[model samples]
Target: MQTVCRDAPGCPEPGPGYPDLGAVPLVALNVSVRRRLGLYLNPRAAVAADWAALAEALGYEYLEIRALEAQPDPSARLLDDWQGRGGATVGRLLELLRDLGRHDILAELRGRIEEDCKKYLQRQEQPVQVPAVDSSVVRTLEMSGITTRDDPYGNVPELFDAFICYCQKDLHFVQDMIKELEQTTFKLKLCVFDRDVLPGSCVWSITSELIERRCRKMVVVISDDYLQSNECDFQTKFALSLSPGARQKRLIPVKCKAMKNEFPSILRFITICDYTNPCTQKWFWIRLAKALLVP
Candidate 1:
């Protein structure tokens, strides 16, 4: 239910004095945030004095430790200190990273962090419906280490960036596609049949999983040869079925070669990449990469 307000035709107040209602906050450190940030900062370290300065300001006596084994990451130690400092938030850390000129790592992290924050705020605005449960059941669930914080899809991680759908005749193009998309700086993980599929696995079962769950997008290589192959036909249709009306834009059609047969009627609405174009070759990979990146 939505309550339209006088602020705008379709707008409404989120709550009383909405913007200041803590709907969006500069998130403080938690175990998950620490673990994520630790990974990003692990490979990039500030000077010892810089870290020491930040630590000292945050009430830590020293950033050093005496140990027989390799020390815990300085980044992790800093995050722990930040947590203990009573809500030293991510915004403060971003300012430090920016000042240190770690822009190489800062660009992606800052973009993703901002996006995640926006999502968090949006989620906070939505009404939550908590079902009634017995106190004993709630305790049992807690004892079993289950909570509302658990990710629904955490167990089933998508292993491939995109699934390459092509016929054997188009394998050479797929090889080239891999060279351009995966081998270069893009470093995309593509699920190609010959390269990624297990030798003894059930083909139909595995292919279904790859299309439906494992991969984020399905790159369909279209050509006269590709149209002739039954497997390519099946895979294309299956991918389309999963995202009817192309709602997710998960099915990406690439015209690797001139096609004598008509384009699939089902995919007519989709804007495809035409490799046949000589002028747009330079921008093709970048455009495709951007498409794959869109969440």
Candidate 2:
């Protein structure tokens, strides 16, 4: 265990005012208002391998998902439009990093190592060898004799490979569909109505945040009820606004039942996946898996 300077998030040597954050539980740290001042919750753990510690040091709020949580239906979260939606699997995030140059990444690793060491001290853990800023060599570091050299964000591992948003009324069918897809090992991060919302989080605010910042792509489970609900309108509108490319590319409309097209003007160009066909569920999952895996 040793005291070290991470200095990320523009904080001083120990990382802002709460120097002991390295010792705090990540879950608790996430809810602490003081720690969220400068940090953005990194859903992709590229910047810090041990995002738990990074959150403590930088005051990042929100759960940083390295891999999606375990689930029964994997396809529930798999994005169907990866190429058009600007999403790459964990494998792609790795390729992107490697393409940026290994030495440069190693330099970043060195800084992250230092930060991890400080955080480890709070856990009564051993310190590992971390490189200095000028050091060019990438040494394998071990705590308790275990090496830590893997990229945290670059790998496709989890159930429900993507996050899906829909009205609660459709959960019965959605869950069944997701279950079928999970047989193919697609994991999803679909939002469960009441279980997912924490007490402190504003429901509307959280919904907007998830649609805008969390989901790689947004799917609207289209039905007559969905189109008529105010809540549904809010979510679909938010999804349309956060889309990265042309509206047609990102907003996916899944027609589960008979429904009228009530999309806003911005979402007019979006593509619709009418699951009305007998094979729509299977075909959509296959397409989605390919999209998430290939690019």
Query: Which tens-of-lDDT digit does each residue in 1-295 have in candidate 2?
Result: 2232232232234445333533322111111111221122223356533323332333323442223123111111122122234432322322333333333333344344334334323333323435675222222121111112223232321222334556778877677656755544665444444434435434455455455544455666777667556566656645543554444355566767755653322233455666776767568766654443431
Model 1 misses residue 107 by how many Å?
Answer: 63
Clashing pairs in 1: none
Q: After superposition, how far is residue 239 of candidate 2 from its true place, in Å?
A: 1.6
TM-score of each: 0.47, 0.40
Error of 1 at 220 (Å): 0.2
Per-residue alpha-carbon lDDT of candidate 1 for residues 144-238, written as tens digits (9 for 90 to 100):
21212222334424367899999898899999989988999989988888876645444555576668767899999888887567577657756
How big is the positional error of residue 88 in model 2, measured in Å on the Cα after superposition?
A: 32
Task: Name the lDDT value of residue 147 in candidate 1.
Answer: 18
Error of 1 at 48 (Å): 85
